[model samples]
Target: MREELLISRRGFMLAGGAALAAAARAGGGPAAGGVPNVVLCMTDDQGWGDVSYNGLKAIRTPALDAMAAAGLRFNRFYAGAPLCSPTRGSVLTGRHPNRYGCFMPGSPIRAQEMTIAQALRRAGYRTGHFGKWHLNGVSGPGKPIAADDPLSPGKMGFDEWLSVSNYFDTDWTFSRKGELEKHVGDGSDVIVAEALKFIAAAVREGRPFLAVIWFGSPHSPHKPLPEDQKAAGGSAYYGELVAVDRAMGRLRSELRALGVADNTLVWFNSDNGATPAGSNGPLRGHKATLWEGGIRVPGIIEWPAGIRKPATTDVPACTSDIYPTVLELAKVTVPNQITPLDGLSLVPLIEGRMERRAAPIAFWHNPARAGGQLNTATGHAALCDNRYKLHRLPDGNWQLYDLVEDISEKRDLAAEKPEIVQQMKTELLRWIDSVAASYRGEDYRRAGIPFAPATRPAGPATAPAARPRRQQRQQARRRRQ
Candidate 1:
């Protein structure tokens, strides 16, 4: 009799309001077991201590500070790679960028790999992508990518997008669903405004949505609005960040005004560490290095309906976890058995049930070879467990640090604990071997998959001078074009 009554109630709901029916079909609304909307906001080169909440004294980020106070913040969060494109790929696939040939910036993500957007779209979610889209290999500064570009967000399952192939500044042109559109304002504000339009429409239709907003501020050639530049006390770099902070504030307040703030999951972080203009706290090294300063980034997630209490955790997490966590929340599964994923879902941690990470995080940065090309002798690699982290430099020298005791990685403990060093070395090598196998195309069912060799464009190089001639040429050509 109870089962019959429950069935009758469900039938009544299905036959009631059109909004309720749409919500039920979209896995939203109270009767359908409320599916939360998702918003992922990532900055270009902001670092671990770039925000005021993390003790940054140079600039103020009241919006982000407020988010840290009202949400779950991550003290030891990391980017998937030390660079932009690779880390973005990991965020979409929950796999290392090398697994799919996105080794560094300007490298395009392979179309064969399944993406989070694709999975969510199958689950009845409206997907939109905004702001920087460096995953496509249109390498100059920023430009509107061709509509038919294989790596565009449309091909990655995003239903709508207003994006640039790379970073943008003030008064930049954006590709709106593959068509060029001009916007006048701060770049960060422009993207957030477009994303809000999509979100508002989804809410009006009672549909769950996934909005990915990638900011192109605080990056090289920093160009902040005049007002923001003045607000930053005349520092162009800090001025760019001021624009980003203001945009973030607008995004949060607009969501609340739309009445979806409580049910929306807004996750914010940086793609990697800082540039020369930013700070990575006390850690050593910066972008392009496999050190704590390169990968460690500020991370926060606000989901009032799910995470009832605001909190912070030091448990290690990375951008790669985004894909799996979203899948877990949407209750979706991949249609095919893909390669082994390096990221684990963070749902357990979000629910306060997890005390430790299930697996250690691994990072490899080798720009000399293409993604998935195994050249252990040519690049830097690091493996970090809960306490100990081992770094293998290009010269084959190994350095070990206990992160808990040395958050800044100032002290090397390799000589003091040889046993732990050997143990970690063995584990790290084993993992590297697996990654090498995947790099050899062993993970793909078909062979001869083409990889676009890194190209050099004709222009003054913005990257390090040590970069190979091929990459320099690629950058030069991109500039000339």
Candidate 2:
């Protein structure tokens, strides 16, 4: 039997319904789940400790805090990658970004890979992606691509999209299914309000919906809207965070008002760890490093009808888990031909049936080496077996940490735990071989392939500076040629 429920806008009153109603009225949107909806909300560069509930003193995140209280808080949750596009790629494909050729930020995920949106669409769900869609272009410092690129959210699978080419802020221009729509307001609010419209319409149509709400905030060039700043007491960054909190509160209230809060599964997290502008509490390292602070993110899963006790679980989890979990929840099946997924469903964990993952997890981040619009480099690899984590850097310097004992990864026990490190190293290498093998056709042979070379420190110049006479001669030679 198809389950159905009606959310009385009146119930929102108990949870500050007036404020929610006012917000809803001012924004003018549809109701919540007349159909099943999935809201996957991500904050760019937001730290794990940015929420007041996470020990952040300067910011207020009542809505996110409330969600944590009423939902499942994953203490060991991690982003799929330590950077934006890579992690976002993981969310879309349910596989490591490297597997699909998304090595770094601007790397494009092969359109062939079956995405979360594509999967949900196959299940008769109206799919939409609102906010940041960083998966389409090269990200590091460089030139921008033509706005006419075909592989955007519209090309990815979302039936509707309002997104920026990159992390945009303040009065930004978003492509609405290819046409541009200029929004004026806090970036966070603008994105959420746009998403609620899709949610409302899907509800009235009695159709299932998947709304991937990826926010562009707290990333860089920190600029908060006036109201958000006022709410956060003049701290521009705090204001950005406050805007997200209000957005969350509005989303939750809408879900309840539409009467689908119980059935809907709302997942909240960050693309990676916090940036330097953000605080990660006890975790060490910042956004780009391999440390916990760089990858470990604040993750919450809420399904009122599904999850029992407002609970907490320390089982290590990753964003890769999102695809599989949502697929299982929606009872959608992937074709046998679509390469097997890297993630396992976390339904068992969410339902309190399991305390730990049944299998070990692996991670990697290989810096890009391709040149021209693509000259980039940032490589990393990691593997986890139970509580032990092994990190393989491109520099050939490997480290191991017992996450159970060293959440911050402050101590490197690789030297002391040689036997375990060797075992993990073997596993990590074997997995890398497997992933690399998949990338290269089986029986494909190559020689002198260098992987994980030792990194040299920058001290004295290795080569003398180019002489002006030599440079002039080179230019003259080029002209003659």
Candidate 3:
């Protein structure tokens, strides 16, 4: 795509209004009204019960708890996948992580995929991304940056980005434009501060904005800000989360103070379920699994002007819903060239009218190995159609779960429920074939690399070096898996 294809900030909003009208017409909904500003706050690796509202006794997340009480909490909300990059990718693309070639952590989102930012940009929204941006750079066991990777937030549609290549703690480097600037402060707080600035500017300009504030908190290398550490008493991990919570409080206060809180559809969620340090409440699996604990996440949607009930809904929603949800709320239209969104909008649920969720949610992970980490692995896929779930792993592993009754997934009913499993497996395989055919591989780091000046490989002498590269990738995949 050419840079000229980019919709200007002003034109994007006008287009969004048009797009909303179109979507409304297509959905047979009432005519669209003024678009709502969107604020999507995602915490890294935050657990379901980490917040007090979710029944955590230790962590003090007053702001999040209050937000939950003030809005609609999704009792069965889930991330698009079990890992960060994949879930984040789903948020942007309105599709399964596998479709966008982001099936694992540190993988790049396909440059060809249409991102939520890009879609919203077409509708005239001022977009900005803050915090972790792991969809760029080299994926192997090296620390060097890939200068030409086309998967950064900028390429994905955000006009302004103050982000890191991946998760960072206190006192991190900010990738501004093409250069890096050292910034002092807790990573979570810094990201929120930047987001606040973007929100402030959008408000001043009288334009609808989509500000994605992704906190790099509570992830690994758990270093908490001093004040937050103190607040957590003795646990530094809890301290990092405390910092994120406090910063979130500041963000909400600022939004309300600026009079945008009522108009802004503020959505808070995590990329996936918790890590070992955190709790997934009653859920089963953690991080990289097909179990509920790996995908189920705490989610809240706060819009004072719209959702007046402040209710809880058992309606199953996934991270994929974010892209279309924001687009629908903002009155943004999906361009003709853009692929159809795999996610259904949750506007009806938000409006408190939708009774039962009908569509199935699907998940798949196919990790690729490179150097020393579990770069990636291959897994089939799974889908939740209403109450039943069917999983088809690459190793021919298949299982079925009755999510409503057995959210833990401790027992597999596939043997007894052979008919349902086969039906769902057929559906899953069809999707897999379609998606895999176009998946050329997510080596975004190698995208713009020059072809070694067409230099011939040093034949026999280089054979041993090639073997080591393969071996290193194998080892990395093992560690990650």
Question: What lDDT score belongs to each candidate, Candidate 1 first?
Answer: 0.80, 0.72, 0.72
Tens digit per residue, CA lDDT, model 2, 208-296: 78999988888888788877788787888888888888888988888776665777889999998887778998998888776788888
TM-score-based ranking: 1, 2, 3
How many residue pairs collide in each prediction? Answer: 11, 9, 16
Q: What are the clashing pairs of model 2?
A: 7-259, 12-17, 106-137, 106-138, 106-139, 365-380, 366-379, 367-378, 367-379
Which runs of model 2 end up more than 4 angstroms from their true locations?
A: 1-36, 138-148, 367-378, 441-481
Q: If scored against the real structure, what TM-score would every candidate get?
A: 0.87, 0.81, 0.80
Assess candidate 3 and give its TM-score to the true structure.
0.80
lDDT tens digits, residue span 1-481, model 3: 1121222323433443344334333332111247888888898898887888778877678988888899999888889888888888888888776654566777666566678889887777889988877665334221212223356677678888877666778776556544455566687777776677677666656667889888877888689877778888877888998988888887787676566777788899999888888889888878888778888898999888888888998888989999888887877776443443567899999998887886878777764533322222356467887688787766777889898898778789999999998888778766665455334332222343222211112222111222366467779999999
Q: Which candidate's lDDT is highest?
A: 1
**What is the per-residue lDDT of model 1 for residues 211-279, given as tens digits with 9 covering 90 to 100?**
999999889898888989999889898899998998899788777767778888999999999976789
- Superposed model 1: Cα runs more than 4 Å off: 1-33, 367-372, 446-481
Off by over 4 Å in 3: 1-33, 139-149, 367-380, 440-481
